[model samples]
Target: MSQTRFGNQIKQATLTPFEKEVIDGCLLGDGTLTKSGKEYRLRIEHALKDREYVSWKFEKLKRLCISDVQYVSNHDSTRFGTVGHPEITVLRQKWYRPVKQVPEDLVLTPIMLAIWFMDDGTKHRDTVDISVHSFSEQSLHLLQKQVSLLGIKTTVNSDGKGKRLYILKKSYPSFKRLTKPYILKCMERKLP
Candidate 1:
């Protein structure tokens, strides 16, 4: 059967406020919205060391999933000389679009920023780097604008790979104040 046709069995549902906050943050970070033909799915994966974190996310999203979250052991004997850490995937065929072009109706909150930082943000010496290299220049600009609306300033830079958004030094205090409360204890390292 076609993936789109098969996947259509799962209906799209509206997200609750809390769900929207968390999932939107996730999408801004490592969460991906993918399509196969006409099927759109949300995919989230994390290393086994983050089992608890992923499990926590699974719990928050399980109601919308067509199947249970699956745990898989990742192996790269050639590269790392041994089977590597485990990981988990929480996949669901939902109708949400990608975060690059955020929906107007969806609200962006500090909690979402915190979650996104947990996913793709790294603490630099005096600035925070949001790994948005996978996004296009236009998308990165949109993200910057969105963040700017929160009173934080961001600049886009291109490394060898792609473009990334840097939370400027001046924005450090605002960024820390906004995302601190939402950061989990395990993800404290992401904080500036």
Candidate 2:
């Protein structure tokens, strides 16, 4: 059905449980919640080489999208950070508003953690690195505490990129056990 059919059919359907967790993770990662005029959308863009991953996410979110996901080649002016790989865009939903700070409504779950890890977490020799430099120190600290509530200890550190968060080596096993089941096969390499 077309997105124009927003009468009763569309209103009847809301984000499924899995979709909710994925959106939570997307928000914590590179995905952006933005607006066009009055409508808000969740925008996710990834390199073309990761087309399969993008496609998988699209499949999971197709019900909320206005149109099919498209792979668009980015020119020099449009390159995000690096160039060469074409990018795919998966935009869906019209109710997600951009937040100035971390939202209290977010209930971080294991699946959400896995998605965020696949998106921005890095595996290091002795610790697990999570790139949260885009967030403020206060936000990072809050996140660290939130993770700690799950019994996983985390620390915030500063780098050239700003503030980054890390799951201590001692917490790696707990973190792994929490998020491993939800991680996608393609992103397995990101885990310890």
Candidate 3:
């Protein structure tokens, strides 16, 4: 999808208050609905800095169960100041879904498999790094803390190399129902 088209889709897609604000800030300006055409970095930074922003977006996206969020990069610099020229191409937000079945030899949980799918999917593999190392042990710890804070009960393996594994003792039916929207929200908050 073209950048303009993707931007339009973000504008038209149903979003939470936080999602709307972030997208609007990126496509438009902070206080205006008119397209700024150059605020991608600023908007992304703003959204990431706000804790509620990312959480809200993630929840909404997971609920929607959207396969991806596509957009284009208009900036010339990386978010981390790397020497890279941003391409004016589609940016996809790949969603993670638990695999119902896998080979018995592979000791992986549904969540782990889902995360793998999101990172390995051809559409986003080149654009985003979803590798196991990318997940980070620190991030997993943070996720565990967050999940606890949110009152979501699950058993997470405390020992792991990079991304720790989390196994829900009592499966939440609601989780399946909310996966789409939750993922979308996550992308909104996490994506630049």
Q: Top lDDT: which candidate number?
A: 2
lDDT (0 to 1) per candidate? 0.63, 0.64, 0.30
- Stretches off by above 4 angstroms in model 1 are 1-13, 34-39, 66-69, 75-107
Which segments of model 2 are wrong by more than 4 Å?
Answer: 6-12, 75-99
Better of 1 and 2 by TM-score: 2
lDDT of 1 by residue, 120-147 (tens): 8788788787888666565566677788
Across 54-74, the per-residue lDDT of candidate 2 in tens digits comes to: 766777766666555565766
Ranking by lDDT: 2, 1, 3
C-alpha lDDT of candidate 3 relative to the true structure: 0.30
Model 2, 42: alpha-carbon shift in Å? 0.6
lDDT, residue 15, model 3: 44
State every prediction's TM-score relative to the real structure: 0.71, 0.79, 0.28
Q: Where in model 3 is the C-alpha error above 4 Å?
A: 1-16, 20-132, 156-164, 177-192
Looking at model 2, the pairs that clash are none
Question: Among these predicted structures, which one has the highest TM-score?
Answer: 2
Q: Show the colliding residue pairs in model 1.
A: none
Deviation of model 2 at 67, angstroms: 2.5
- Give candidate 3's error at residue 24 in angstroms: 14
